[model samples]
Target: MSADYDLLIIGGGINGAGIARDAAGRGAKVLLVEKDDLASHTSSASTKLVHGGLRYLEHFEFRLVRESLIERERLLKIAPHIIWPLRFVLPHDKGLRPKWMLRLGLFLYDNLGGRKLLPPTRTVDLRQLPHAEILEDRLIKGFEYSDCWVEDARLVVLNAMDARERGAEIRTRTECTGLLRGDTHWTAMLHGEQGDARVTARIVINAAGPWVDGVLDNAIPGIKHQNLRLVKGSHLVFPKLYEGRHAYIFQNKDNRIVFAIPYEHDFTLVGTTDALFTGDPDKVEISSEEARYICDAINEYLSVDVTPEQAIWSYSGVRPLYEDNSGNNSTVTRDYVFELDDKDGAPPILSIFGGKITTYRKLAEHALEKIGGFEDRSWTADACLPGGDIDPARFDSFFAEKMAQYPWFDPEGVRRLLRAYGTRIDRIIGSAADAGDLGQHFGATLYEAELQYLVEEEFAASAEDVLWRRSKLGLHIDAEGQERVADWFSART
Candidate 1:
């Protein structure tokens, strides 16, 4: 039987969305399905930094760090609106990782990826104004380095949107229930909002992330495909802890690092405990222990002390890391590995094991190359996602232009839109002379127009999808406004 698509990609997370975008750009007929919203799980739950993993130097994962560092600049260039540079302060605590050693690692990290575009690491005195009042007395010395911040969920959505524009079919709220291999093609059973349908494809890519093993078992029965080590990373959102745009990377006595980042204007994002997780990925939540650990880690470096009860919001996601049999969960290799099963010219199913957001574009390119059908090229590196066509250095100019163009709208709301939509801000504010022209007021800066644009362009089906993932408006929008947005969706459906 003939195949319905050149590529059938399962999972709508960053990896799968990226693969769909790249493959479709190469002229492949692609179909990508997700059991939930794009980036609803791990992709949306990242620490939201596009860094080279400075600590990875300890484990000596040079290649991974190098690739990530290189991608850091590339991503910033391509998506300047949602991505930009931020400084990180790594203090030299006396008892852990010596100062000289830290210098050596920073040196390597600085030069590893042909460092350009971002500033290099430099030493600093934490005794200075910002740090003196914020951090502990002992943390008098530190090094400040650069990394880019990303709207993680927006990255995934933009990739999927780009793929759809390139002729790929992206189906959210769609699940691939089963897979059957054949000589020339594979058949998949899909259960989605419209009901069940069977589809065929010449190649299948299993980028299911946390559910990779489950998908593998469904594809090739009778084999226990226990290749994943689900590591749960959780984060806490607290009222602003410090007064700087710079983020802090605190080294704990346990040899782990926790980050305190400036978040959503009103809160500090602190987090990311590396604990082994065996629960359902969908129901992953921050354990009380993890929360306390994070608070303790924060207390060690910051002058102000915090308790678990003070946290306003928390989230957790399991990293579907390839089980490398490491002694510690924190030390598990983050590099990706692939499993290809195509014996004697039988239909091939490529299963992606492990990967991080920083290297997702490289991962997609490599995955396509491994499958060996599309034109092998670096087209994606040069191509821009949906609204990311502006030059990185000129983003401020672009924003200024948009602000001027929509002078009648609230300046702050326009700024937020530009950050989320980039060049596509016009799509929402096109020809609207005033705020009243943008449709009904839901709450805060959210109008019916922007919400409509999200539903129409970004595949947003719910209020949570709008306020939380597509943008962090949930932090600012009031509860009555949020409920009205929900009502608006329900009225439409």
Candidate 2:
């Protein structure tokens, strides 16, 4: 039987959207369905970094670190609007790992993966710097190194947009309910806002993230599978802790590390506790203990202590780490694993086990290799994502040009638009002469023009889609402003 699509991807996180973009560029008839909004879960809930995991060196994950580092450079080049360099300050704690060990790790990090473009790691005397005032008096030295920050959820949406532009079907809020596989094709049942629908595809790629096993079970009933180990990571957002563009990485007594990053212009983003998680992934939230744990971890290094009550926002995500039989939850591999199921003449099903945001494009390339039958070689390596065509080296020049072109727009508002949309800012700005021409203001520089562009071009269906995922304006807007945006979406829909 003839198939409707060449490939059917069941997930809309980074992996699925990335694969859709890659496969569609290769001329495949692709259909990607997401059970929720793109990056609604794990992808959006990342620590928002594109770094070579420095701590992974302790686990001897040199290969993953190298690949991630190399890809970090590539991603920064391709998506300069959303991904850019940020220096991380890691204070040397006398009670934790020795300074020598930290130096060795940084040295390896500097040399490994053919470092270029980004500045190399350097030792800093905390006693002389403002960081000294931020940290405890006991800490006298620190190391600062380069890593890129990412608007993670926006990355997913941009990938999906590029995929769709390349002729892939992107369906959000669409759940793959069931699958019936045949020798040459598989029929998939999907439920979404429109209603139930079925599509046949020659291949099925299950990138369901936390629900990978569940999707597999639903597709091929009773098949033995034990591939994913669910680990919950939680993050907290507090009012700005310090005044700097540089972020801080604190080392805990247990050898774990936590980050305090500048976020949303007015808040510090502190994160991530690794704890074993079971049960439904949808219900996952940061526990009181987890919040306390994060507060205590940061308080160990900071002179001004923080409490859980100070956290204005918090989020939790469950990582579907490939079960490698590792004893420690944090030690489980962040690398991706693919399990291809093809028996006799049956159609193939490639299930993505585990992956991180930094290496998503490479993961897609490798996934295509595993699926086979594509004539085109790797193209995303050189191709830019949507609105990512601006040269990384000339980003400042480009921003200046935009500033001159739209002198009527507020400088900060223009900067925000450029950061979110890059060259595509014109699509939102259009012929607008001033702020009033941009249409209704939804607070925090979110105008009706941008909202309309998101709805029409970016597949943003709700106010949350615009405020949170497409951009982080939700952090700045009040509840009343949010309600107005919601009303706008409701009225339009």
The model with the greatest lDDT is 2
TM-score of 2: 0.99
**lDDT tens digits by residue: candidate 2, 1-493:** 6999999999999999999999999999999999889999999999999999999999999999999999999999889999989999999988789999999999999888898889999999888768878999988989999999999999999999999999999999999999998878999999999999999999999999999998899888987677899999999999999999999999988888999999988999999899999979989899999999999999998989999999999999999999999999889999999999888868999999889999999999999999899865899987888899998889889989999999988888888999999999999999888999999998988899999999998989999898888888889999999999999999986
| TM-score of candidate 1 versus the correct structure, residues matched by position | 0.99
Write one digit per residue (lDDT tens) for candidate 1, span 325-425. Answer: 99999899999999998889988999998899999999999999999988766688878887889898888888789878987888788888888888998
Candidate 2 residue spans exceeding 4 A from truth: none
In order, the Cα lDDT scores of the candidates are 0.92, 0.93
